[model samples]
Target: MSFVAIDFETASGYHPCSVGIVTVENGQIVDEFVTLIQPPNNSYNPHTIQVHGIHPRDTQYAKDFGEVFPEIQKRLQNQIVVAHNENFDRNVLIKSMALHGLHYEDLNIPNRWECTLKIYRSKGFKPAKLSDCCRVMNIALNHHEALSDARACAYLYLLR
Candidate 1:
């Protein structure tokens, strides 16, 4: 029942503009980490901004993925990682690492993360986006905001 639930909001392409990690132990949340990240070249897409409300200016002075990898590594290495949409979040992590010349193999996490979206789908939850599942389960959510999404993903996993 112990795991780390993570979420990432991209600035453009697979470049992470923000990240959130929630650590759970014995089924209870024990720690939470969230930070805005400077994407490659501190650039952002207008469409992504509409999704997460994070503009280039929001992370202009924030640390880049390389600068923040140590923190991400300490939490995720050798841990059970979960996400609402595992494929997307995992790709963001891997691609962001690659963008910064960091190797994904060094993290020692599984290639496939536990996915709440897929899990809920299997259990017959239709329209199982993070927000949809959260709404059905009465879990509070802030949608594309990384920390809130991660926290909601964690709660949904616990319920599952």
Candidate 2:
């Protein structure tokens, strides 16, 4: 089985400030890509900064999401994408791409994505935060770090 696990950290609202991608083939992670993204503008919310510890200054020299999307699509196109919270990540991708005048479908991403958060909840785990699920599954997590969260999500999905 081949799939890509992804996670996004936002600077403010739905603006993606960074991305993480872990590509799994035959159930093993084969590659990983993580990068900070310069959003359309350098505006970051303090609350979001506290959540992900990413500030505008950190991404000032980073590529824009538009510049980053090609690599992301190369990893994810026609592949099953997994995220801890599919809705939020998907929305972030959509909104951020739109801000760059790109359509989400233009990336040819797979429609059938998996949500590990929902998976854990359906398995009778309450309050399936990424950290909570990681604890239950003996997976290591660094909470809101995009790459750490994506890697944890990939491990969680493989265990399932």
Candidate 3:
């Protein structure tokens, strides 16, 4: 079965923010998508050169969640979506998407999910953080961008 692993890098902190996705097919990453979304209409912290490494000004040309989610939905349709903390990633991202008036219920795909964090824990692994697992698994994930993180999650999903 094919799957898409996803990760989100918020502006500063995590929660209620933008996100990205990495889709894997045939043991390869077929597509990568990123968006500069307007946060929960609340506030956007700092990700400048850090997690997302995106400055607020950089998002000037990028589309908000409302504009870009259609593409995200197209790719995710009927695909397995795996994440480190699958529920959290998917939930937060779903909520983040909602900021633009979109919801998972609006999608045709109905994503099937798996949480690598839970998987590792059930296997007696000590840590479930993507970076930590990548360290142990020898997968290289760049600091904190969405694509890199998603690829890392895909690698961990492979372990199972």
TM-score of each: 0.98, 0.95, 0.81
lDDT value, residue 150 of candidate 2: 98
Name the 10 consecutive residues with the lowest summed lDDT in model 2. 104-113
Q: Lowest lDDT 10-mer window, candidate 1?
A: 93-102
lDDT of 3 by residue, 34-137 (tens): 66665434346754345556665566556666666677788777777888887767766676666556778665544547888888888877866777788888
lDDT order of candidates, top first:
1, 2, 3
**Candidate with the larger lDDT of 2 and 3:** 2
Writing each residue's lDDT as its tens digit, candidate 1 over 1-160 gives: 9999999999998899999999999999999999999997888889999999999889999998989989999999999999999999999999888877889998888999999999999999999999899999999999999999999999998999
Among residues 3 or more apart in sequence or in different chains, the pairs in candidate 2 whose N, CA or C atoms overlap within 3 Å are none
| Tens-digit lDDT string for candidate 2 (44-135) | 98999999999888998999888898898799878889999999999998887787788888767765479999999999988899999999
Q: Candidate 1: where are CA atoms >4 Å away?
A: none
Candidate-wise lDDT, in order = 0.94, 0.89, 0.70
Ranking of predictions according to TM-score:
1, 2, 3
**Whole-model alpha-carbon lDDT for candidate 1:** 0.94
Look at candidate 1 and tell me the lDDT of residue 28: 99
